[model samples]
Target: MQDRTLIFVLLLGLLVCGAVSLTVGSPLPAADLLLAAMGEGDPRHRLILLEIRLPRVLLAVLVGWALGLGGAALQALLRNPLAEPGLIGVSASAGLGAVIALYFGLAGVWALAPAASSLTGAGLATALLLTLTRRGDTLSVILSGIALSSLAVALTSLAMALAPNPYALSEMVLWLMGSLKDRSLHDAATAAPLIACGSLLILTAPRGLRALTLGEDTATTLGIRLPALYLRVVGGTAAMIGGAVTVAGSIGFVGLLVPHLLRPLTGHDPARLLLPSALGGALLVCAADLAVRLLPTPQELMVGVITALIGAPFFLLLLLRRHLREALP
Candidate 1:
């Protein structure tokens, strides 16, 4: 009952923030003007409400939700709070795929070029990660992820360095920074189904995830099929994180922070954290998007930049606490 109340309040807060984001921007539309625009909106006003603002807001919410859920699941499965989709080369590999497609002129092959390449790359990286760490130690898995991420980033840099077209280089740089600017309905549509399906898969695996709370040997003793469960978790994570990066270009740290913020409410139970973490993540990102628009700045910061700024300090705090704990007798 308490959990439901907390989730309801968080979700309601997110909805309110989202509505406020729609109403406020440069020149800051009046409340009456905003309502009038919504009622009998002119093309210009409607375009601002729908195309310019709404897509940015929605994409932020969706990406944050996906990352938060995926991160919580990964941490639960690995029993490591540091486990995150981006930490494991997922986002880097997806960025590499997108950069390659753009560099090769394949990004213009169709409307789906970027999405297809990103999904493919994420899938490959995930497969490599699983293979390298199959029944291996946690430290080994983390090392493998770091190696893969380094390789992907290096390749992405090489591609950008060698690109013959300045336009392609410009696009690649913008993408690596991660932004939700000027996204269209097509981008949203392509990613939505994948995120939905991935989220469903993660949510459905609660039983298996809970089983994993026991040691692997004990889980096996209890008749859980480790291989199948791992496949489902990895595949679902790839789909959502890959599709998200495809559209939004590597937004960072929502995965890392959202779960931490909501875990207190979940009593540290991975099962209970999933839905609440997703909601909290959506709210955080939507609130950040609102801040980006409301801030008095000449240039708009990417949503990713805002998250990293907020998250970096939190990450450092966690590291400090952990260090202190380890140092204590």
Candidate 2:
């Protein structure tokens, strides 16, 4: 499909999925839900649609967009198709930060504390990675990312293990598993600025990324400042991934999957992949959340679980295909 056509289709899917999300779990008809959202229907239905559902839908879209865009930017920067926000440890560290806030009871008192903490954690991880890999070789960066992610994961596990009570442990586990249930407009509002800013930052790097495709020396020859490009990508990834983890916990693979899925449609141009990936991510998350709501289980499945179920198999298939191609010779 043409890039423009694919993007339009993804946007249409996002809108349709978002609409379905708002009305999916409610017993009221779609028309009634729409009326309630506009404040002209039953009060209970109105509360369900507006107070409960709309914010969740919005959060899903925002978080998914950030992850997808951040992933694409990172992949472009690293020139690694497998690179993602989580692979660099930012998401794990951000989750740890939020967990610390929750464990210390800070999140209960300050509406923004969790997100702030998450951002700090993500920033620190990026800083450490940049410091250790001063030469910025692709292999060095990836290795450092792996080490940082491992450390973050270990710390998070330790925190869970030492939780003061079962309730705390359960809360941490559920949060890590990821869900959009019970999120409010306040959560969405708090995350919006960070996500928006991060997206703008990432969007600014496409020219540099496109240039770098020819190599750092070539990009420098083209007047792209490598230092500034690195900073922009790191800062943008931190903000986007941190905000996303804060809002929805460590929901995985939207970043890894969305860009990969849409890259071909964008003619394999990293610059062209950003917007379509964002829209596709939003559409996927919204649809997944709706599916979780509609499932027959006594408790709704976590959105993360659904994404994992989908992404894990796809990842294995990707590996298998690569191995087969490599073995073909």
Candidate 3:
């Protein structure tokens, strides 16, 4: 009951933040009644607020939710604090898949090309990592993911170099950097269902995650099927990550930061961590999205750049702290 209350409060706060972000820019009057007087403002302003800005806000929420949930699940499964899409190369692999589809003009012909290719790349990377980790230790899996990520990035670079049209290459580079500019309803619609499905599976399987935290032998004693649970979490995270990259072009660090940031609030219980992390992630991304818009610049900053700026130092700090803690005792 208390957790439910917390989740509701967090969600409400996120929504309020999103609402404020929505109203901050443009020619629309800030008054509720005035803004409610639809069809009264410049059509472009109205469309910008309603169609462009709203969808981007919503996308930030959904992407954050998926990334947070997936991160928590992966961390629980691997029994590591630093595990995330960025560390494991899932985002890079997904990017490679999306680039392949785009370079071949598959994305231009079929709206689903980017997503399908991303899923394929993610699944393949997951498979390769699993296969390479014969003993299935955390270290082995992490190393495999790193190797796969390097390979994927190399391939993506090759594709960019070979792109037939410079314009297409330019657009791909911009997209890879990540932004919310000119997003539309269709972009949200494509990724939402995939994220929703994956989230449902993770939320429903929290008991298994809790069992996992005590390690494999203990979880097996508790009647948890280790292989099945691993598949569900890993595969579900792949779906979530792949879908997100397909739409947003590899926005980084939300998955890496949200779970750790909210763990204290959830008492460090993975079962409790997942949902709160989702809400926290939504809040972070929406706030960041608002910042990008509010910043005075000739060109709007990439969302990924902002998140990396904040997250990279934090990541290094975490590693240093961990090293110090280990060295102490």
Please list the C-alpha lDDT of all candidates, in the order they appear.
0.81, 0.84, 0.80
Best candidate according to TM-score: 2
Model 3, span 73-105: residue lDDT tens: 888878887788666677899889888888988
> What is the Cα-based lDDT of residue 36 in candidate 3?
47
- Against the hidden reference, what TM-scores do the models get? 0.87, 0.91, 0.86
How does residue 167 of candidate 1 score in lDDT? 94
Q: Kindly report the root-mean-square deviation of model 1 from the true structure over all alpha carbons.
A: 3.1
Task: Give per-residue CA lDDT, model 2, range 63-92, as digits (tens).
Answer: 889888988988998998989888778888
What's model 1's TM-score?
A: 0.87
Which digits, one per residue and each the tens of the lDDT, describe model 1 over residues 198-277? 89988988877777788677877888777766667766777888878988888788888888777777888888888888
> For this target, which candidate reaches the highest lDDT against the unseen true structure?
2
Q: How many residue pairs clash in each candidate?
A: 0, 0, 0
Q: If both were scored by lDDT, which would come out higher, candidate 1 or candidate 3?
A: 1
Give the better candidate number (1 or 2) by TM-score. 2
lDDT of 2 at 115: 66
